[model samples]
Target: MARIFTVDEARSLMPAVLRHADDFVAVRADLAELTHDLRHEGESPLGGLAEAKGLEARMDETLSWFDDQGIEIKGVAPLLVDFPALMEGVAVRLCWLEGETALGWYHRADLGFPGRRPLP
Candidate 1:
């Protein structure tokens, strides 16, 4: 069974979540640059294929961290995450997207980001 998070429990994890999210963004950017360089120049100054592989591994590890925490990673580029939860006994997700300073939004399990509503 999935771990269901209370709003406060999810909120308490924000600090670590933000840290991993930042790291994921930085690593993703570096990997993109490396890929572009290799494609255009036949080689990159960014330590070649080995470094790219390392970056890929790092990205995987970051994602695994989220999974281990029972948080669903909905998107990579924008770093969207959802904590499984129940709102007034209805299954929902406590949503947090990149650049949001707090866990201030939610949506029904059947709905997605388009259905997001501010937390009451």
Candidate 2:
């Protein structure tokens, strides 16, 4: 069974989530640049294959951290995390996108991001 988070519980986790999100974004960008360098220039001053592998490992670890917390990872480029919860007995996801400052939105389990609405 998945862990269900209450609004306050989800909100309390924001600090750690934000930190992980920042780490993910930075590592992703570095990996992209290294990939581009290797593709176009045939080598990257960024340590080539070794550095790229390290970045990949770091990214995986960050993602695993979220998964271990029972938070769902919906997107990577613009990091999106969803907390499973029940609202008035209806299954829903408490949605938090990359740029949002707080976890203040949710969507029905079947609706996804397009159906996101403010948490009442």
Candidate 3:
């Protein structure tokens, strides 16, 4: 079932989301640092590139975290994207967990794009 959130209910999840985002940001930063070092250190650091899937798994953890909290990622359609400030191909959206209001917003996945929208 879809977890439609009221504005307030959705806002409550911000702390959790922010915390998870912080974790993700940290991992991403570490990866970036490693990538930089690889430029001087050579391709040896690129070994176990598959293990870097940890980052993707962590992201899924965030989504699953939301699912456990009762929120659902709206499918890639029927989006409530009515905004003047939206960048090309995306408009701010309201997403939430079950029995909650819209908690925050996310852009469709684009590799390494940091753009995100907190509940308005």
Candidate 4:
């Protein structure tokens, strides 16, 4: 019974979504870089447990950010969406203006940006 939203409706929520997205990506990137450092150089690029804790903290921050915007990340595989009442279906996920498609595509949570597909 989750709400489904139209591309426009989703787009309208972007400003807030983007805020969370920015932090999410930054934390993700930092984590990735830290992993790379551990793998290639055998070094802890981010220092110690505080860094790990910080990543988790950032993730919590992003979730809070989404909550503030009234959006929730539901599935893991090509994320299943529960948008507003714009489109009224579970097939569509949020679409951003900068996306290659016109907010008119399907994307899984796992696939992220690469999962975009034309609406049928």
Predicted candidate 1 versus true structure: per-residue lDDT over 1-120, tens digit per residue: 999999999999999999999999999999999999998988887768999999999999999999999999999988899999999999999999998888999999999898899999
1-120: candidate 2 lDDT, tens digit per residue: 999999999999999999999999999999999999999999888878989999999999999999999999999989999999999999999999998888999999999999999999
> For residues 1-120, what per-residue lDDT tens digits would candidate 4 score against the true structure?
565566667767666555556657678777777777766777785855568667878877766655555566664223233344333444545644322223455565455557666555
Candidate models: Cα lDDT each: 0.94, 0.95, 0.47, 0.57
| Model 4, C-alpha of 11: deviation from truth (Å) | 1.3
User: Could you list the CA RMSD of all candidates, in the order they appear?
Assistant: 0.8, 0.7, 10.0, 5.4
Alpha carbon lDDT at 80, candidate 2: 94
Best by lDDT: 2
Q: What is the TM-score of each candidate against the true structure?
A: 0.96, 0.97, 0.45, 0.56
Best by TM-score: 2
Clash number for each model: 0, 0, 10, 8
TM accuracy, model 4: 0.56
Q: Candidate 3 on 1-120: residue-level lDDT in tens? A: 444444465566667655654565566565555556656675545343544556557656755665676554442122122112223454333433232233445443341124544534
Pairs that collide in candidate 2 are none
* Candidate 3 global lDDT: 0.47
**Stretches of candidate 3 above 4 Å error?**
35-51, 70-92, 95-120
